[model samples]
Target: MEQKLLNSPQSEVNVIDSLFAEMVLDKALLDFRKKKIQQKIDQSLQDRNKREFLRLSEKLKDLS
Candidate 1:
């Protein structure tokens, strides 16, 4: 029982570390996607494409 108690913290730490890694990955992916969408939105403006602009705007809004 003493050994089990000592080993339990390691398991808890592993779970916490795994969750942190996942959160970092998710944030990075989200930042990448938002950057890409903004680029498209800018291009849409430069090209004077109203339809594309509105569509990309909604996509960017949905991310937030």
Candidate 2:
């Protein structure tokens, strides 16, 4: 009976289906983490830009 099940086409299909599902989940999780890290980096850059702009504006005011 075990040999017969192994030879069956359905068993092969089920194995392939499970493997594809696992690959998809792994890719999705990786993408989510990548996006989250990018957002944090962008926020840091924005903050730095704002601080530099303010500093420059203060210098211009002092010169005037």
Candidate 3:
């Protein structure tokens, strides 16, 4: 049965592969977004924007 699915033109294997790739991309995007938020926090800290820094920190916590 597994072999049959793999051999079929419209295969479960292709669907699984596509879903896996999409999952990987989604994870990468989340990670990138977290990093960008961190950078903003760091900048806010340097520029002494206390309110903005706290807001970004809260966003970071939510992401994690």
Candidate 4:
């Protein structure tokens, strides 16, 4: 890692870009899971399933 830092400036830029890309991917995945869980919660509500609704609600809250 020290050697890479001592290398050219282009290497540093590449490292930074990769880190940013990873963060974006992570955020997208989290959003997808939260959205899916929310949908389930809504369905549970429509079906009048209190147990499922509460469970899904907790799962969604944890994501937030």
Candidate 5:
């Protein structure tokens, strides 16, 4: 850190502002990726359930 920046209030404010912005951006990116992953997981579960249901139905039909 520069000695001049340590003595300057404006420089401190600027550093804080930049850090805050970076944190906000990181959080937003994390949220977006989380949502995408959850969507994929949900879709996979739905597909598995449908396949299971179809298999059971076929088994029932063969029993008739």
Candidate 6:
């Protein structure tokens, strides 16, 4: 039975083949968007850190 099924050409045209390509494309787009958002968040955090550091440094200088 398995040999007979494998011998059929129509079996190759399954649901997986029809949807796999589209799914891969969608995944790539989603990954790109996620990376872009992550980069923006990282930049914002770095900016915040620099501002805090400078503020602290100024306060220390005033104390002296």
- Residue 63 in candidate 2 has what lDDT? 38
lDDT per model vs. reference: 0.95, 0.69, 0.92, 0.92, 0.69, 0.64
Which residue runs does candidate 2 get wrong by more than 4 Å? 1-4, 49-64
Question: What value of lDDT does candidate 1 attain over all alpha carbons?
Answer: 0.95
lDDT of 6: 0.64
lDDT per residue as tens, model 4, 1-64? 4565547898988889999999999999999999999899999999999999999999898889
Which runs in model 1 stand beyond 4 Å of their true positions? 1-7
Pairs in clash, predicted candidate 5: none
Q: Report the lDDT tens digits of candidate 3 across residue range 1-64.
A: 4555566867877888999999999999999999999999999999999999999999999999
* Per-residue C-alpha lDDT of model 6 across residues 1-64, encoded as one tens digit per residue: 4454754666666656768888999889877766665565566567887665555555545534
The best candidate by TM-score is: 1
For each candidate, give its TM-score against the true structure. Answer: 0.89, 0.63, 0.79, 0.86, 0.65, 0.50
Give RMSD to native, each candidate.
Answer: 3.2, 13.6, 4.7, 3.6, 13.3, 13.8
List runs of model 5 lying over 4 Å from the truth.
Answer: 1-6, 49-64
* Count of backbone collisions within predicted model 1: 0
- Model 2 has a clash total of 0
Deviation from native of the Cα of residue 53 in model 6, angstroms: 18
Better of 3 and 5 by TM-score: 3
lDDT at position 2, candidate 5? 47
Q: Model 4 residue 8 lDDT?
A: 82
Clashes of 6: 0
Top lDDT prediction, candidate number: 1
Model 4, residue 6: displacement in angstroms? Answer: 4.8
